[model samples]
Each structure stands twice: as structure tokens, then as C-alpha cells.
Target: MTYELRDHTADVAVEATADTLSALFAAVADGLAAASAESVPDEGDRFEFEVAAEGREALLFDYLDRLIYERDVRLVLPADHRCAVVGPGEGDSGTGPSDPDEWRLTASARGVPLDAVAAREIKAVTYSEMALERRGDEWYAYVVFDV
Candidate 1:
């Protein structure tokens, strides 16, 4: 897992890279968690969710947005995640993002309760300066958020 927090004026920018799409998404989720909480508590509950989009970049956006939504709804900070890219059908695995409508994701996310962690409160995940692309066999995404 590789990620960095780049300075983005009023907001925060996260750049993540991985050998696979699922790992890339997980890194981005972790970056968000790191930005939101000072330290993510280890003893937290895990939950699963599925998110899909017409394109790889959109999928990343929805994946991060879902984590934020879960945080606000459950009053928890997502500390970690494991994800897999799949075909359109449930439980179907894929080689990773290739087309707009062919890829989807299933993610298991762990969360530390809001009261158990120091929260920074990320407002939303923004598309401004956001991108997801393939660099050789690795995948990379640069996302900006409204903090």
C-alpha cells in the first residue's frame, strides 16, 4: 500500500498507487481515514458494501463517498478496507478495470466509532483534480476532498 497526502490549499489531496484496482481503492480509503482521524482505533466493527460505476474513476469516487457516508451514518471512522474488483454479477471476479460498464467492487470496511477517535470531519470527496489511471501494470488515483 502506497499513499501520500499532498497539500491542496483549503482541501486535502490524496495520491495512491497499487498493483491492482482493489488495492488502489483500499489505499485511497485508508488515506481518507488517516485524514479524518488522528489515529484509527484497532478494535472496530467491519461491514461490507458494493459500489459500481460506468468507469474506473467513477468507481473510485463512489467507493470513497460510500466510506464517508458510512462514517456519517454510523458515526464511525473507517480505519481500513479490503476490496475486490468484479464483473457485473455478484461474486464474480475480474482482472480489474477495463471498461465503463464492466467493472464493479465489493469492499469490507472496518470502522472506529466517532467517539473512539479524533475526527477531522471530511465534508465530501471532490472530483476536482481527481483522476484514476493505469500506469503500466499499476494503478494510480489522485483525489481532492472538501475538508
Candidate 2:
């Protein structure tokens, strides 16, 4: 997985890619960790979740929103993830948990201390021109969040 920060109208923009959706989400978590510049404790604190959306952009937004919510509400930082498409279909709608193109993600994350450095607070995931697609063997996504 890989992540890069870019200029955006919001607090920041993130671009991530991976061989699989799980890898992509994991990379996005690492990117979020990097954004905070905080050292996440390496402990086995696992969480399970499922999200569905009408399209790929919505799915991506939901994925990130879950991460942010976990951070804010649960203080969890994703360390590893495994996502698989379980449903059928194509494109965004096809790429979900219930759809034929659905994906199921199981992940392990570290817990951030309450006294950790405060970074930008992610308010919500945005659909302001988000993108998700596949290029050959890799999956790619671009996301913007309201801070």
C-alpha cells in the first residue's frame, strides 16, 4: 500500500493504492497515521465492521469515515486489514459487502493514547469528486475529508 498527500480545498487530500481493497484501506490508515505524525502502539486491538454504499465513491467515503469514527470514538488505528469482494456486480455499486461486488474487511489496529498529539480532526468523509478504480492489477482511490 502507498499514500501521498496533495493540495485540496479541504484540510488535506489523500491518494492511496493497493493490490486489494483490504490493502488499500490499510494503506489509507497508515496515511492517516502519518498525517497525525503520532506513534501508534503496536498491540493487538482488533475491530470488525461492515459498510455498504450505492457506489464506489460512497463506499470509499464510508470506509474512511469508519476509520475516522474509530479514531475519534474508539481511539483505534488500523494496523492490518483483509478485504474480499463477496458479491456480484461491477463498478462502485458492485464493490460493497452485500452486493455481488461487495467486500468484507477484517482488520487489526493499534490504540492511540488519549494524550496523543492532536492532529486535524476529520469531520466527515466527502463525495466532493472522490474517485475509486482499478488500473491493471492494482486498485486506486482518491478521497477528500472535511476537517
Candidate 3:
């Protein structure tokens, strides 16, 4: 997975790509971590989260929102995640065993310390012109956050 940071009006734009949706989401989270300049601790607490969206765009928004929530609200910086979509029709959404519509993510993140000056706060994840697409064998996503 890989990501590039772009300038935005208010917040920041992140473009991420991976071989699969799950990897894409993970790359997005890593991008967020990089933006914050906070290292994801190798040893930390684990949490389980589930997000449902109307479609692909909303799904990506919700997924990123969950990660931001963990960071801002729960004060956790996730290092790894296992995500899978539940329910759907076909393509991004499927009736097969693995789909990319709805998602359940189990993540490991570092806990925020009381005197951590290096940690940066994220206000929220935005859906402003967010994009998710599949090209050849890779999956790509573009997102902007409201910091």
C-alpha cells in the first residue's frame, strides 16, 4: 500500500492505493498516522468496529471516520486492521464470501499518553469528493479530512 499527501483548502487530501480494499483502508490509516506524526506502537490495545454505508463512497467515509474516531475520541492510533464487508449485490458489493460494501474492522492502535506532545488531533473524516476505484489489479481511494 502507498499514499501521497496533497494540499487542501482547510484540511488535507490523501490518495491511497493497494491490491485490495482491505489493504487500501490500511494504507489510508497509515497515511493518517503519517500526517499526525505519531508512531503506531507495536504493542497496544485492540478494538473491534463495524461501519455500514449506503454505497462505496459512504463506505470509505465511514471506514475512515471510524479510524479517526478511534484516534480523536478513544485516543488510539491503529497499527493494523482486518476488515471485511457484509451484505451487498455484486462488484464492490457481493453475495460472495468476501465483499467490499459493509465492513467490520479489528484494529490495533497505540494509546494516547497524557503528556504526548507529538500527537496531532483529527477533527473528522469528510466525504468531500471522496473517490474509490479499481484499476486493473489494484484498488485506489482518495479522501479529504476536515481538520
Best by lDDT: 1
**Candidate 1 weakest lDDT stretch, 10 residues:** 89-98
lDDT of 1 at 19: 93
105-140 per-residue lDDT for model 3 (tens digits): 433444443244365666777878788899899988
The TM-score between candidate 1 and the true structure equals: 0.89
**TM-score-superior candidate, 1 or 2:** 1
Largest TM-score belongs to which candidate? 1
lDDT per residue for candidate 1 within 78-130, as digits (tens), equals 87789987644544454454454556888998878899887998999999999
By descending TM-score, how would the candidates be arranged? 1, 3, 2
Cα RMSDs, all models: 3.8, 4.4, 4.4
RMSD of 1: 3.8
Task: Candidate 2: give the clashing pairs.
Answer: 56-92, 87-100, 87-101, 88-100, 88-101, 96-102, 96-103
User: Model 3: what TM-score?
Assistant: 0.75
Off by over 4 Å in 2: 38-44, 76-103
